[model samples]
Target: MKGLMVKDLRLLFSQKKTWLMYIMLCLMMSFSMQGAFIVGYTVMLAGVIGISTISYDQADNGMPFLLTLPTDRKGYVREKYLLCLLMEACGAAVGIILCEVTSLVKNGSGVPADDIRSAVVVIPVMLILVSFMAPINLKYGAEKARLVMMIAYGIIGAITASAVVLMQDIMPDLGHSALVKIKVFFDETLGGTYFWTVPVVLTVLSLAVMYVSYRISVRIVSNKEY
Candidate 1:
């Protein structure tokens, strides 16, 4: 796992422009929104940048060589997910520090507790996104998987909008169903006390999804001729 992580980190840092772009983006975004949203965006950026390592390894027929090393297919997938988690941690940490500093400069104080709580949850959310994506990315290279994910998200959003708009007319109180739960969750996490449970629940859910995704990825890798 250590070697695999080192390899991906080396490949990831090889793209200096990506790091610079993220740096500039965070700096620019800091002025436009609060610290929590900035951290959320950074978390998503980490997920995208981390998954690109798979595409990098696929380039020039690199996977075969990587598998020939002292790592198996399952190990490779595990390391990829672990590497993504590491990237998320690093990105979130950087975002928190930057946000705190920016908040201090702007308001003469550090980031608020609400902002910190929201920022922490972004890591688990990004983990869920990466977990769902890594298998699709491994099965079909990054470019195609990216298009698929975009389309998938678009369709889901459209359906959700249609459901919320149309179902309310039929049920009249449909909005009170799921939205209430979400509102309560958000209120507790941001407004009320016990915000820490949000991260704990999200981390558990994310790990469950990642474990299922890992099993699927292993099957895909084992069945394919590499």
Candidate 2:
């Protein structure tokens, strides 16, 4: 597993142009985009970076060669997840720092507490993204995984639209007053504990998803001849 991790990290860092491009994009967005948005963007790019290493491993008979080493299929999956976590965490930290620096330069003040809170929210969201994407890429390869994810997104959007329409028809009061009531419920229920509870819950859920994803990937790879 340690060797696998080193190999993946070396592959990731070998793409100097890609990393440079991502850093430039993040720097540009840090100045222009919303603080929270920049954080999410940066972390998502990091996730992509981690995912790309899988593609590299699959290229040019890399997987066959990798299997010739001591690491097994499960170790490969675990290493990928660990690499993703490390990269995304670094991205989030860098993004927050960039946001603060940008705010200081532009407004002579630090970013708002709410904005920083929102920035932190991106970590769990990207974790879920990474978790969902990893096994799909492993099972179907990158090309087919893209199509699957697009179809999945389309289905999810369609269902959400249908649900919203159904809600509008079933509960005619689901407009302004209902929205306010929902907001009030959340605020009253979570006002004090919202900061810690929401993040902790999301992080735990994301980790669970990652665990499931890891197991699935292991199964998928282990069954393969390579």
Candidate 3:
């Protein structure tokens, strides 16, 4: 398992595309003038880059070659998931540092503690997104899985929008006050001192998801004729 993970890391580091994505992330970080913008970009980039890593294997027909080695199917799948989570952590770290530096230079201090707190909320959400998508990618390959994930995301967006619209209709008196209240709740509860727990829970959940995904991928691949 360790050898397989090392090999995957080697392949990831040696790839031009990987470096290109990193460069793009760095450039984006440099241009982000606000902490909110930085956080948004970081979360978005992490998802895109992580999904691309999975797609690269499918696109390049690397899976068959990887399977031919002594590595087991579970090890292969687990390694990819682990690598993606590591990439997310790295991206988050870079983004936080960039935001701090930019804020210090432009405003004498980086984004406020509250803004930083709010940004931390995205960490678990991103992990949930990745965890949900990883098994789909492993089971269906990149293209099909992407299509399914897009549909899923669309449905989720629609549901959320509908809920918001319905709430507005039901509580005309509240106007946007409800949203303000919800935001305050999130800011004070989820984004406050409890924020640190998000990463810890996300890490644990992601590992659990990876384990399950690994088992499923192993079962699928082991039955294949290749």
Q: Per-prediction count of colliding residue pairs?
A: 0, 0, 0
lDDT of 3 by residue, 1-226 (tens): 6876676566567889867876776666666556645764676576657666667777768878777788777667667677777777877787787778778877887678666756766766677677778778877888999899999989999999998899889987585887799777756777756756655776677667656766766677667654
User: Per-residue lDDT for 97-208 in model 1, tens only?
Assistant: 7788788888999888877887788788888888878998899877888898999899989999998889888897767877898977678666566667788788888889
Model 2 residue 142 distance off true place after TM-score fit, in angstroms:
1.0
Clashing pairs in 2: none
Which of candidates 1 and 2 is the stronger one according to TM-score? 2
Model 2 alpha-carbon drift over 4 Å, by segment: 175-182, 185-189, 192-194
User: Model 3: what TM-score?
Assistant: 0.77
lDDT of 3: 0.72
Q: Could you report the Cα RMSD, in angstroms, for every candidate shown?
A: 2.3, 1.8, 3.5
- Local error of candidate 1 at residue 186 (angstroms): 6.1
Which ranges in model 1 have alpha carbons more than 4 Å from their true place? Answer: 176-193
**TM-score (all chains, Cα) for each model:** 0.89, 0.92, 0.77
Give all candidates' CA lDDT scores.
0.83, 0.84, 0.72
Residue 188 in candidate 1, Cα distance off native in Å = 6.5
How many clashes show up in model 3? 0
The candidate 3 region of ten consecutive residues with least summed lDDT is 32-41
